[model samples]
Target: MALYRGTGSGRLSRGLLLLLWVTLGSKLCPTGAIVQGANTSLAVPQNWTAHESATPDNKSQLPQFTLDDHYWLFAHFCWINFTIWMNNVTGAQLCDWRIISRPYSYLQYCLESAAEKLKFGYPNRIADDYIFKSHYIYFLNCTQDHPVLLDPPEDMLLALIIAPICLIPFLVTLVVCKSKDGKTQS
Candidate 1:
């Protein structure tokens, strides 16, 4: 039986092939693999101001962050990253944990504060008890202007997804040509 026939049938075949390719492609190349060197930076948009600056003097007074809080934030970050990758969103999104510098050190400061509060194996009291959680939320809400840079492993995995899509045309051509050759031989 012939695979592709008239133009209408050929279109239908291509569409079905595309659908199959996507389905198989996703199964073959899953996302969120957590490959190392998937480094991305978070950028604070202009006109956005942090509620308070974390300074050396106040480092001893920041509230503590619980294990659950850390876990929740980690999950949130993963979900956001997954969404960005899945949607292939253009431009950068917020990734506060990736920010390691001062002035915009939302995540770094929060973690340092958490560590400080846990000194001597005991949680310390602070002026604002909810400081850690608040800052965590704030950083989560920050925006990233730069795109996520995928490392070699991640690049190859992503290429696996695209390579098949790109080969669709060549694959269909090969199939059609084979059918034509068979007909001629017959």
Candidate 2:
């Protein structure tokens, strides 16, 4: 009876630990950063409707860009490109076009320029600044006055990677704890 009780407790503890691992792992996973690029059928936001209406040809209006939004956009691009390079997706093409390619062109120069103009990192401990406006190209130097633009927060990528790693130790600890309980019961 005592052995059975110990085994049951061990199993319960292991199950609980697994649950905790999954919960923590999920919290760390990249949730919002992933985007489906081919989904042009997505509903346009209301703010975009005003710009669309103003541009009769649909070519004159600049695409509205936000720093956080662009960061995720670039992150998605990087993810897609990495996947393509790994041959996970079929018909993925890697090309080098100057400043007008689909994703790269939109992010590389234009956004940086706008950030500089807006003084995104000026007069502050601006660790980094990234701009993603559609039609501007800018770059700001890293200084006490100028904010850094290239580096993003640790959470941006670390959470996506580290959270999973952290789970491994957590799982191992739980398993060891459970197994010890089982052996002691026998």
Candidate 3:
């Protein structure tokens, strides 16, 4: 019976790990929408616009544009970076921008903020569209402004490939920790 219990426990752990992996992976994995560009420009939703700013500098400055909604903003940044990479710009050149300074810092901040605001519905889906449009415009403008400097030697796809692989172990650790604590001690 002890041997059977051990085997069952091992299987349970493996199953939990698998479940953790799938959930974490889905949550962490960039959604397909991350690649999709919005066709229309975003306008603050009706009534919601009253709280929004004509121009928002920082998250706090805007009344309607809560710090929570910044995820869309960060997504905009990633979309911009991804577009730049697709155009063949080097990560270093992209990083040269003060905004993109710390690796994934902008995205992390946006996600954290967005998570908080998810309940309010203040970050309407239109925000996503707005981000895409802005990114597309910025990308075109940058290329036009600096044709020579914009040309990158490295493959953007290669860099994207490396990102998730690097993240997997950290995710695994998180899952292990969660699993260990999830069960009650006798």
lDDT to native, each model: 0.39, 0.37, 0.43
The CA root-mean-square deviation of candidate 1, after full C-alpha superposition on the true structure, stands at: 29.0
Q: For residues 51-153, could you state the per-residue lDDT of candidate 1 as single tens digits?
A: 2443447754233445543433333333233322323222243343343233234333443454455441223223122234434533445555787776668
Judging by lDDT against the true structure, name the best candidate. Answer: 3
The predicted structure with the larger lDDT, 1 or 2, is 1
Q: Which ten residues in a row have the lowest lDDT in candidate 1?
A: 42-51
Position 15, candidate 1: lDDT: 38
- Give the Cα-based TM-score of candidate 1 against the true structure: 0.20
Residues 62-126 of candidate 3 have per-residue lDDT tens digits of 33445433444444434433333233345345534564334334434444455465543434454
Residue 179, model 3, lDDT: 86
lDDT of 1: 0.39
Deviation in angstroms for 11 in model 2? Answer: 50
> Over the stretch 56-121, how does candidate 2's per-residue lDDT look in tens digits?
357454345455333333333333232222232222232223322544443344344434655453
User: What TM-score, over all chains together, does every model reach?
Assistant: 0.20, 0.21, 0.23
Order the candidates by lDDT, highest first. Answer: 3, 1, 2
